[model samples]
Target: MANDAIPVRTERAMMRREDNPFTFLQQEIDRLFDGFGRSFPAFAPPQAMMPRMDVSETDKTIEISAELPGLETKDVQLSLADNTLTIRGEKKSEREEQDKDYHLIERSFGAFSRSVALPEGVKAEDVSAEIAKGVLKVTVKKPAPKQSRQIDIKTAA
Candidate 1:
């Protein structure tokens, strides 16, 4: 029994040593590099996901508004299929003059697609989408409810 206890304690001590802060950090760094290698064969850092989206819903409809600065309406596309609404677009920036140098280019210029699941009982035929002022708005209307009929009960004499 004592011999068994000794091995268990030794294993716990070894695990504690392996879990040291420096060792954990080194393991995390190795894991990150390994993930990067798997994700990017050319050893390039992974790009970040797009920013958050703003969605609004009312009793009658759902409205999705996305801020896409420097993007034209021609560059955007909206579609609905299989109860999923997808918004795809691209942002391209061109130099106005060849002699001018761009000191900073923080805006992203790439294709992006965002999809949202449509709720049940939504009227897909009544969906409307619009883009204005660099903001894309999608509206999906809810199905109209069935009208209820009043029932009158006769009083017993």
Candidate 2:
């Protein structure tokens, strides 16, 4: 009896699809930014370094907390102006290892800026910030509600 060999098929690497100008442009732009990120160690891609945040509001205060692991108070800046609360910071870290056969050093750096628009009547003096255990806490005191006063009509002079 003669043994028959089974046929095996292999697929090609390229798949056929309709050419799209917009897709091509988008892909090119993405590649550009990716290459730029790889070339510059100090600059991170957009939204890459955005810290996780939690915001809460009560009758008298708006509290915000951001998780900024490995960051210290000196590395962060907080400001309020024009009814906007801005948080800015730069993170720099380095690690070094030395052995008899090999020596290695690694560094990482990135900057981040985030802003939150405060509700009308929130003043800079009413805001406070504190940092501890790699977490940033911000408190905004809401302004007291103004009472409407009735005005009396005057006769023409």
Candidate 3:
């Protein structure tokens, strides 16, 4: 009985690593999307997904600038964590028109989020954000570099 079980165990151990359950599922999903896109090209997105951003750093501060067109100061929010910064915005727009011959109305809204990883020296508490002309700028002061101290230990005489 033991000799018969050994061959089955060996065959099971010979399974390929790429045959992992999650990886197999991902490959199947990718294949489905490939075929679906060939059948219907309109399902593709019309525009880019997220807003464009620029990140720069100076001697004492780091700056992040994002281009958010048609957004006001109150439409965006910022948050910071350990070496990570997050920006979220809600774009709510509305329009109305009336005339003797015709009338029309339009409204649209969406929410977007972007997260960035900052350098090691940034200070979250000193971060600040400002919006001007549809551009959002965030500044974070760089903390002073940490110094290492050596401790001395004495043995009993």
Candidate 4:
């Protein structure tokens, strides 16, 4: 049997889609910020050190997942108010060795905060948070869906 296979074209590293002006502008802006971060690490915003988060919504609940590395539950704090969930935590460095030669200190040890807007129906009082491994999960209960009703029309007599 003869082998017959067609070659599939794949995107190259240099072939980026920058036709949209906004996309180009966004890329340029991101590059500018990257330069700033590399140049002035200490001047970076506290929120930049905050862990990244993802939010998802369902019919009756809102769930949020955050990547919080090297943090115990005691080191983290959370609060919710006015339909906004605020996450606060500090990454502390424990250097117990006094005579050990230090070569590099790249770990970040500072307080960081992040706030997330809750959906319309979320109940602030009915919220729960859990920390497992290096991830933090938050769940907020939303109001129940309204029941539909029908009304009969009456003729004027």
C-alpha lDDT score of every prediction, in listed order = 0.71, 0.82, 0.77, 0.81
lDDT of 1 at 95: 49
Q: Write the per-residue lDDT of candidate 2 for residues 1-157, one digit (tens) a residue.
A: 2454864443432433336566788888999998875566556556767887899999999999998888998899999888889999998856556566864323345788898888888888899999999899999999888889999999999
Which ranges in model 4 have alpha carbons more than 4 Å from their true place?
Answer: 1-45, 96-102, 145-157
lDDT preference between candidates 1 and 3, better one: 3
Put down candidate 4 lDDT per residue, 120-147, tens digits, no spaces. Answer: 5656578999999989999999867778
Strongest candidate by TM-score: 2
Instruction: Compose the digit string of candidate 3's lDDT tens values, residues 1-157.
Output: 7667555557658878797788799999999987764454334332333678999989988889998888988889888887889998887655556566864322224677899988786766789988999899999898888999999999999
Candidate 2, lDDT over the whole model: 0.82
Give the range where candidate 1 is weakest over 10 consecutive residues by summed lDDT.
42-51
Reference-based TM-score of each model:
0.58, 0.64, 0.58, 0.61
Off by over 4 Å in 3: 1-49, 95-109, 120-123
Model 2 residue pairs with clashes = none
State each model's C-alpha RMSD to the native: 6.7, 11.0, 9.7, 12.4
Model 3, TM vs. native: 0.58
Better of 2 and 4 by lDDT: 2
Clashing pairs in 4: none
Tens-digit lDDT track for model 1 on 12-83?
576775678888899999988878644543353323224246888899888888877767778888888877
Model 1, position 105, has a per-residue lDDT of 46
Worst 10 residues of 2 by lDDT: 9-18
Each model's number of backbone clashes?
0, 0, 0, 0
